[model samples]
Target: MIRAVAFDVGETLVRDDRYWTSWADWLGAPRHTVAALVGAVVAQGRDNADALKLIRPGIDIATQYAAREAAGRGEYLDESDLYEDVRPALAALYAQGVRVVIAGNQTARAGELLRALDLPADVIATSGEWGTAKPSAEFFARVVDAAQTEPGETLYVGDHPANDIVPARSAGLRTAHLRRGPWGYLWADTAEAAAADWRIDSLHDLTQIVSGAG
Candidate 1:
């Protein structure tokens, strides 16, 4: 039985594309351009946080664009809006008595982002806090330690195969793959095809998986 569940923050639990699209629009460039830039950065093997720093110069252009959009509409694009869409699923997991923790690579701004979105503080665990990244057995081990759960009793759900599935499984934790789109190292036309110990297409599907409803 799965007693605890861990999640990845960016694309798995939250809709990262929303923020990227917003940021792109603010920069007065096509969204795909920014997407390509990010892809290139990742291709270069720079971690997400470091890539952001390398690309900081381009951010001003986007910020200026967003400012103009806000002025024109007399409203602001708040990152908090994205959280509203995700909180219900998180709350549902909590209600199920599954100890939920976020195991991800993030920067110091992650706390600010979480607070801006009003996400629960008690459940978070990040590389920024832990000083390691996923796909490392040690990283998952740390999560297991933090949750006070054994490997067999824990499940880690994430979008990347290398970062989420392979490592979690290696560390002896059960795994679930959340298939959102064509984004990660893992590709499953549907969640069922992901070949994880369990598979889910949406956050709502998680309740049944965790509760053994299926």
Candidate 2:
């Protein structure tokens, strides 16, 4: 049985339309252009941030990030950014006496915004705050540590197969691939995705998973 559930932020719990759209505007590129570039980069097995670099070669992402903030345009999150099933599903798990954690590749400020929402979770952590990011063994180690459970008894859920499923599985945790986002749908039919302990269309599906129906 799964004793704890840890969720990815973007495209898993939260839809990232706002993030890419804001980047397009800030980068002075067409929204569709940026979106297409993002897809292209991801398809090439390149990081999505490379799309921004493709828009402006030699762009220093960290510096540009600060510039965007100084210009009154920066990362922002609210209830509306979340997927519809996030609260109910997480709340149900928490009420069922399972530990709920939200851990993902996100900025420190994103972590603050997530906590501000006051979601029913035992912990909400970001790569920036932890000084490590996913696909790294250290990152998954921190995730299992935060869950306070044996790796096999913990579940790591995310839309990205490479970052979420593969690394988590390598770290000895059970994995769930969510087929709800772009990267998810793109690779859902692949063998890597099939290797996950479970494939879910929604967080609501997890209740049954933890209950042993999976």
Candidate 3:
């Protein structure tokens, strides 16, 4: 029986591609170029922060784009804005009595993002705070501890196979791979081929997965 469900915030629960795309457009570069740059940095075995540093030159251009949006009185480009797109889905899980927790890596601005999205204060657990990142057993262990549930009793849903599924599985948590785009090779085939404990195409499918687990 699943007692708790932890989520990867970026791309899994929320869509952050828009931010990256917007940044790319502002820099007058192909979106794929920016993504490729990010991929290369991460491939070097750098942490998210280190990867960001490698991409900072590009990110500064993106920040300038955000500034332009802010000047135009457009919706502010906030990291938390990603969560707004998935609030209803999250609320649905909460209504179903699932204890939802976020296990992510972020800069110190994470709290600001959460507040901006009006996310409840209790559901977040981050690498910045925990001093560890995914694919690390210690990171998932903190999530298991925070959720107050044993590994076998929890389900971890994430977008990345290496960062999300592999680590959670290592921690003995049931894994769900959220099929979105070309983010991972696991999604290149079908969800079944990915071999996650569960595969979901949308957040709406999560409740049914949990209910069926019982």
Question: Best-fitting candidate, measured by TM-score?
Answer: 2
What residue pairs clash in candidate 3, if any at all? none
- Candidate 1: which stretches are off by over 4 Å? 18-31, 37-85, 184-186, 189-193
- For model 3, residues 1-214, the per-residue Cα lDDT tens digits are 7778888876775566665665566556778877776666555534433434454545563366457567663223354446443677677778878788877765334534554666532478568678887778998899898778899988888877778887788789998887764454434355432767877777677777888852
lDDT of model 1 at position 188: 58
Over the stretch 72-141, how does candidate 2's per-residue lDDT look in tens digits? 8999999999999999999999988889999999999899999999999999999999999999999999
Candidate 1: pairs in clash? 27-62
Clashes of 3: 0
TM-scores for candidates 1 onward, in order: 0.71, 0.98, 0.72
Clash counts for the predictions, in order: 1, 0, 0
Give me the displacement of residue 77 in model 2, in angstroms.
0.3
Name the weakest run of 10 consecutive residues (lDDT summed) in model 1: 73-82
